[model samples]
Target: MKKAFKYRIYPNKAQQALLQVTFGCCRFVYNKTLDIRKKAYETDKTKLSKFDLIKKITPLKEEFPWLRDVPHVCLPQAVYNMDAAYQNFFKSGKGYPKFKSKHRSRKSCKFPSSHCAVLQDTSHLKLSKLGLVKYKKDREFAGVLRHIVVTQESDGRYYASCLVETGADAPEPQPVEASTTVGIDLGLKDFIVTSDGRKISNPRFYATIDRRLACLQKHEAKKTKGSKRRARIRLKINKLYVKKRNLIKNYIYYVAKTLLRESQTLVMEDLNIVGMVKNHSLAKSIQNICWGELRRVLEYKSQWSGHNLIFIDRWAPSTKTCSHCGFHNSTLTLSDRSWVCPGCGTHHDRDINAALNIKRMGLASLLPAVSGFDGRGEVGYGLDEASICTV
Candidate 1:
């Protein structure tokens, strides 16, 4: 398995200058090569491979001598990065690769294993051109180093993310049973509501900083552009954003860890988050809650821990369906927090009922071949026929 460990690095003035030059060189190479490939394809329908682009780096250095100032390896890595982006576009029908701007794009460069190393003392990192940069090693990591990506954030902080091969096989997935399985519904009101009656309150990290963030932005807008004062205001705004992101990341990790620790089989609705965010009134709240980030964390963590993570169909009517008697409430509105099933007279808390329905549907989907249930109906695997028709 491959995992990445990140550490904050403190570099001297000279090293910082060198790092900035390297970032510019890498960006230049990437953009130049992308332009070359794009023009080739357009003019002659010719396709240029990564190696072809890498071979051009030597000629580029001869033409533009400043490129030789950075480590030779960094240029090729840029080509590789561009190649990966193109490959993803071709394979997944993703957006076409666009030119990276110095001001708008992320400033970063990658170094292969041969060009980067962690010192034995664990307090410093060694790069080909930037040697012995000091870093805060918060924890020890054991694995074969694959590569390191050094990045400079908008807040002017430097971080190095080291990718390593752990060499440990993933654990075997446990059997999915009724008692061990759980269904979760993610919402803005509560971060998560599980079928087992657990509600993890939404922290609303962004809300806590909204006023300060707005004030900073307002001040930034007033400052003269290209002035030191404007830069200072911009930095402050970036720092505020960084702080908010970190808070949300930590909280999401905690929520995912807590849920995975209890359940072996975890199920959730395949929410159309992009569509949901289109609602102007809820967009801010939706983004701040980060439903997508929580789902992403749960996915990878569940795989590492041998837990089954299942996502039910997006259109499965989990919200309006009654978990008790499988009664479908067609008239339920978004404002109705709790509703009583007309058929079974069972009262339901909206979110919890949705979670329970999601759980049942997921379990039913897993056993469709044996249960004779198509997994599309409101009534799930074990529901009695009489109860299913009660409505």
Candidate 2:
């Protein structure tokens, strides 16, 4: 198993300067290699592998002597990272490699284990070029260090994320049962509504700070660009953004941890968040809810905890269909929060109904294949049988 531990690092002025140079060098290497690979493929349909790109770094250093000033190991790692991006592009048919911008792109660089180490005191970290830098180690971690990535955030805070191999086998997933299973419907009104009838209210972290952030931005806009005042205001705005993100992250972690601790098989909708955010009216709210981030956290944590995480088809009519009587309510509008099922006279809460349907859909996927099991049945197609099997 592999785990990552992140800690804030305080680098001296000289170390910070070197870190900035290392970040620039790494970005330059990545963008230059990407350009080379793109042109090679476009002109002659040639492919450049990781090693091939690494071989070019030597000549690149000869051409640009400043590249030699940063740690040598980081340069090759940059090529490796670019190669990975290209490979992912080819595999996914999306996310083509793009040039990293000095201002917009993330300021980060990777260092191999040979060039990085955590000191015995655990309060200091040693890197090849940058000597021992002090860091706040919040928790103890035991593992063989694989690598470390140093990142400088928008607010000028620096952190180190250390990846380590724990050398432990992951627990096997437990069997799914109705009593132990749960379904989650993520929403803006509420953070989540579970099949078990639990509703966790959305904290609306962004909304809480929206007015203040807007005020800060307005003040920042009044300042002249490239001026000290503008820079100070910009830093303040960035810090606020960081605070909002941290709040949301911590809340989601708590929610995910609670769910995984209680449920054996967790089911959720595979929402198309990219498409959902297209609605101008809901874009800001949707982004603030961080549905995608919550799902991502649930996925990895479930795997780590040996729990089953299930995502039903994105097209599944969890919202429109009646969970009680298996009736398809095609007329159910987005504004309809509560609806009475015409088929069975059952009253349903929209989110809870959707959650139940999601749970049923997930359990249906685990059913043994049979002649009538088409796998595309409606939300409550075989609810009775599933309930029986789960019991």
Candidate 3:
């Protein structure tokens, strides 16, 4: 098994400057290569591969001879990544590659320069360009380093992620006795309301910290673009975003672990959250809950613990399907939070009913009552077009 451990690397001022220069150079090369490919298609049908592009890099070496000694892997990795981008485009059949937007800054670069130091046992980790950087977090890792990826964040944080091969320490679990299976209904009002009368409210960390973030953004806007003041403001905002993300990730891990520890089987309604976020009123709240990420954690955890994870179909009528009596009320709408079941005298909480129906569907899936989704094949992406069949 491979595990990743992240630590804050404390690079000195000089090291930070050098690292930034290297990062800037890498970004320049990546953008240049994309331009080259774009021009190649525009000029002629001839294509340019990494090998063809390496010759052009020689001119770059004359301009920055220091880069020539930087190491082979670092530069080639960028070219290979560009190739991979085209590969994925064809695989997904999601139309032609669109030019990356300035506002939509979602990409990153890697440096595999041999000089890029591995996480070693010295007082600090030394990189070729960055020099020795200290850390407070435990680097006493117990795994062999398999691969390393050095990422330059858009906000200018340098992170070295190591893929390490570690021996599994999983305990041979005792056979679980009779335990309850559960279905989860993720919502905006409540973070999650389960079939078993359990409901957790939305923490809304982003909403809580919105004022601070807005202030930071305003401060950033006031600063001259590319000035030191702008960089400093951007860095502060990046840390806040990172902090919120970490908190959310930790909370999700806790919930998923707790659920896995107690349950023998976990059932969830297959929701295309990407699609659900289209409604302007609920989009912000939905993004805050990060329901999709929560489900992902539950999936891997349940799989590791030898428990079943079932994803009821999107069209399963979980919300409208009555648990007390097997009645499918097709007329149930979003506005009705409470319902009087015509089939049986039962008061059903909207979320709870959905959860129970999910549980029933999960149970039914285990049997061969209907064509059970094998969780294989292409899954949903985009608005409600989900990739969660195997969820």
lDDT of 1 at 125: 95
Q: Model 2 off-target regions past 4 Å?
A: 120-122, 282-289, 368-391
TM-score of each: 0.92, 0.91, 0.77
The sequence of per-residue lDDT tens digits that candidate 3 reaches over residues 144-226 is 66545565455556566656667775444333222367777875468778878888766566665667988999999998988
TM-score of candidate 1 versus the correct structure, residues matched by position = 0.92
Q: After superposition, how far is residue 170 of candidate 3 from its true place, in Å?
A: 9.7
Positional deviation of residue 358's Cα in model 3 after best superposition, in angstroms: 1.3
User: What's the lDDT for all of these models?
Assistant: 0.84, 0.83, 0.64
Using TM-score as the measure, what is the rank order of every candidate, best first? Answer: 1, 2, 3
Clashing pairs in 3: 275-383, 275-384, 375-390, 379-386, 379-387, 380-385, 380-386, 380-387, 381-385
TM-score of decoy 2 = 0.91
How far off is residue 381 in model 2, in Å? 7.2
